[model samples]
Target: MSAPITVHRPSPTGGRRVTVNGAIVGLAHDDRDLAEFLRRAGLFDAETILDDPRWVEWRGGRAHHYEAA
Candidate 1:
């Protein structure tokens, strides 16, 4: 199986960093940006990505501002 995707919010200005298998994919400014990045990378569909456990782990089980489109 592919390595799990990782989302990180390092700094308020740094935006969200998306990584897969230790490779940096993109730095997103918001939910839409993140979705776009994932779409472009063809890693996961928006719905699946939003529902992924990795997102919950990264966000401490809290809901983020981004929603699936």
Candidate 2:
């Protein structure tokens, strides 16, 4: 099964689109923003879970990369 959370590629203006269970959550420019999104989604310890494959799936670019090139 795929991860429940997906961090899409960064846009030309920067920031990545985040989704949960196939529904749009918000745009995250950095780890802080991502943690907040997860917090709103009822996920605690989001920082520790960010790199966990079972929790998040990074796409289009490497994880934590928010600059379009």
Q: Please, what is the whole-model Cα lDDT of each candidate in the order they appear?
A: 0.59, 0.94
The local lDDT score (0 to 100) that residue 21 gets in candidate 1 is: 61
What count of clashes does model 2 give?
0
Candidate 1 global lDDT: 0.59
lDDT (10s digit) by residue, model 2, range 1-69? 999999999988899999999999999999999999999999988999999999999999999988864
Task: Report the poorest 10 consecutive residues by lDDT, candidate 1.
Answer: 60-69
Question: Ten-residue segment with the worst summed lDDT in candidate 2?
Answer: 60-69
TM-score of each: 0.62, 0.94
| Pairs of residues clashing in candidate 1 | none
The digit string of per-residue lDDT tens for model 1 on 1-69 reads: 443666665445556677766767787667677677777767557656665675423542233543222
lDDT of 1 at 36: 76
Badly placed stretches (over 4 Å) of model 1 are: 1-3, 12-14, 54-69
Model 2 residue 35 lDDT? 95
